[model samples]
Target: MSGARAIVEALEREKVEYIFGMPGGATLPFYDALWDSKVKHVLVRHEQLGAHMADAYGRVARRAGVCTGTSGPGATNLVTGIATAFADSSPVVAITGQVAKAMTGRNGFQETDVVGVLTPVTKYTVQPLSAAEIPSAIRKGFYIAETGRPGPVLIDIPKDVQQEEVEMTFPESIQIRGYSPNYPVDVQDIERAADMLARAERPVLFGGGGIRIADAASQFTAIAELLMAPVITTLQGKGTFPEDHPLSLGPIGMHGRAEANRIVQECDLLLAVGVRFSDRSTGNFHEFAPEAKIIHVDTDPTEFNKNKLVDLSVLGDANRALTLLYDALLRRLAKRDENNAWLKHVNQVREELKGIPAYRDSYAELSGPKIVKLMRSILPPEAILTTGVGRHQMWCEIHYKVLRPRTWITSTGLGTMGFGLPAAIGAKLAAPNVPVVDFDGDGSFVMTEQALATAVEERIPVVSIIINDRSLGMVEQWQRLMYNRRFVGIRFQNIPDFVKLAQAYGVQGRLVGSLQEFGDALREGIRSDQPSVVEVPVSHEEDVFPFMPPGKGIKDTVYGTSKEMAVF
Candidate 1:
């Protein structure tokens, strides 16, 4: 059988249901082989969108999503998408076609070093020298991409190799000599951490994306209840704990809930689970959790002292560590003091923040945060929400109530701009029964607005709520605050009407002029059986607040104008 056939057979063995990609010269043979296979192929408008689609699929499906691109420019186009997946620890297997192996170093047509280009952004990069190695490479790619710290794996297959015939023998299991993913929890570490939690006067639980990746939301919730600590989720960890829960303090970091930030400031002990303590999460890091003793639990050993130092470190899978810690804490309950005082304080903070209005009295105008809050009130409980990186992303993180894990999706680390629309398509494909919505800023949406055509063609009914601010909203806010409002390339004079653009792509479109219009449009978009875009013209000057000033501590956050008038 041909190498292309062998590749398809290996994918079939892996039970790959879909492959999102674009077709080109070097990949013709592989596409031909795919024609005879059961694996459904989703042709994307761009290679980058294909990668984003695969990344979202991986995050939602809990499996390695597959994406393909042609050589040279096509491979390079997949770079940003792969980096985004790598940064967020999403499992994706990206395959890129290459020029013939015999054309080595000659700079053959459409030739590029796919392996070299993708090495920094991928868990593994392989270029099989022969068709015989294709099966092993493909198998190992999937395994590596999904196991341990999940990430993208790049497999560069040359054109000749795809055309070559080889006696195929698929490996049932792979053993990479130096690769080991499983890590057992240290009981002593858990005991020490539990003891710290038990003795603390004010303890807070900090959860990150790792908890969701480990599928340990239940265990995390149990631990939170056992400690009776107020839980604060990182941006990537938003849905791991129900936002409406009594103990939930919502996200704590830059642009996080004011109450959550204040509670973290007052906590005496912080039990950080699977959180890497990114700068955005920690503010200035030096002053973050200054009053607290932090017990950090994570799978990666290198993350131990990479950011903030910890009083104790538990190195293992989030699920295993959380399970053990929960069990250990239950045993130590008799000796531990009750957390009534801390619970009362947490409740007070929550009530105070609730009374301190999130919006101004003049918010009759349509704005991102108001839209996000409206969606939270209207969106189905099981609906999956995705966001492009910007002010709108922060608005969703702050105002959107995420009730379950894997239901909230966004680019947390890389903060890719054009991630929302395509990612929403991938999320919808992964779970067709659930409603999907993408909260996108105007600047971010236009970068990959072409993806709407793909959704229309594929019949994916994802709603895109575009906050049309006519500027790079986040950067404009930063420039206004830090650079004396000297905005350079921030404003757009004449832009394509997003509603008209969507209509041109055969998508249902709506222009929202008021709050009532927005609600009507959103409901219509949600109920529609086809892809739709809702463009909301918002104030270009509106800012996402509870803003932590650049290079400042979390406690030094600026409440912005009109916020000072807020009362509790």
Candidate 2:
């Protein structure tokens, strides 16, 4: 058998259903092998979109999504998507074709050191010197990407290696010298954490992406309910806890709900699970949770003291730690403490600021928050949503109600602008029965608008809700507030009509001016059998509020047009 055949056989053994990629010279042999395999090949318009698709697929399916690109430029193009996956801890296996082995160091056409370029962004990077190593490298890549702190892994196979004839022997079980994904949870740490919670008057449960990544949402929720603590999530942690639950305070951080931020600051004990406490989540590390004693539980030991210092740390998988914590806490506490003054106070604060940055009538002119709220009303609870990073993404973060885990997919950690459209495609592929929508800003959408071709060609029926603000909304907002409204190179003068562009790509397109029109368009798009694009023209002056400026604490959140309106 040929090396390419061996690779395909290995992928079949791994049960890889789909491989998102583009074809090129170095990958021709692999593609030939793929043609006769059970694995489906999704040819994308660009390598970057292919990578994003794989990332989203991995995130939604809870498996290692595979993506391939040829050599040099093709491999480099996958960088942004791969980095996005790495940042969010999404499990993805990127297979890039390398130049022939003999072309080493000669700067041959399409020859590049993809392993060196991707090492920083990947959990593991391997370039097999022989075809015999292909199966092991692929098996190990999938294992590494899908285990522990899940992330992307890169496997670069040279052209000669793919063409070389070799017998394939897929490894049933393999071990790496220093690679260990799971750590045993110390019962003493859980006991200490339970003690802290038992004595605490004000306890807050903070959940991050790890909960969803570990498939431990149920465990986290049980712990939160057992302690009757207010639940706050990070951007990547949005869907782990049901947003509409009574105890749910929604996401916290720079653009988080004002109530959540206020509660985090006032809490006495913060039980942070599967969270790394990123700078965005902790506005100012010095002032964040000053009064709270934080007990951090995470799988990665390196994240212990990387950001905000914790009173206690537990090194183990989120599922294991949370499960044990719940069991331990159950033994200590009999029932929810309804008479606790701290719980009453937390509820009072939540009620007081429930209307912060008030929502406009659905009939009024379209705004980011209003649009998202309307979409929520129209779409089913199970519908998945992806977003491009900007003011619009913030709005979705604020208003979109995620009822279940793995439903809210966005570029949270990296804040990649062009992530939405392709992500919607991948998400739809992962969950064909559920509706998938891409809530993207005009600026962000245009960056990867070419993805429409792939969606149309592939018959993916995801809807794209483009917030056409006619400018880089977030940048303009920053300029308006901090730079005296001196906007430069942000506004669009003569841009391509997004509706027309969508139509050109064989997608259903609608240009909506009013809220009713938008709702109509959205409904039509969701019901359509093919991909659709709904372009909504919004004012560039509209900004995402409850804004925390750089170098400021959560207490300094700007609620409305003025700082005086921050506190109600």
**Reference-based TM-score, model 2:** 0.98
lDDT of 2: 0.90
TM-score, per-candidate, Cα-based:
0.97, 0.98
What tens-digit string does per-residue lDDT give for candidate 1 at 449-537? 98998999999999999998899999999898889888999898989988789999999999889889889988888888899999998
lDDT of 2 by residue, 1-568 (tens): 8888888998899899889999999999999999889999998989999999999999999998899999999999999999999999999999999999999889999988999999999999999989999999999999999999999999999999999997778899889988999889999999999899888989999999999988899999888888788999999999899999888999998888888999999999998988888888888898999999999999999999788889999989989888888888888987686567878998899788866654333334878888899999999989999999999999988888888999999998899999999999989999999999999999999989999988988899999999998999999989999999889989999788987899899888999988899999888888887999999988887788788888789878887775435554
Q: How many clashing pairs does model 2 include? A: 0
Show model 1 residue runs off by greater than 4 Å.
334-339, 355-362, 562-568
Cα error of candidate 2 at position 80, Å: 0.6
RMSD (Å) of each candidate, 1 decimal: 1.8, 1.5
Task: Give residue 118's lDDT in candidate 1 (0 to 100).
Answer: 91
What's the CA RMSD of model 1 in angstroms?
1.8
Q: What C-alpha lDDT, on a 0 to 100 scale, does residue 351 get in candidate 1?
A: 75
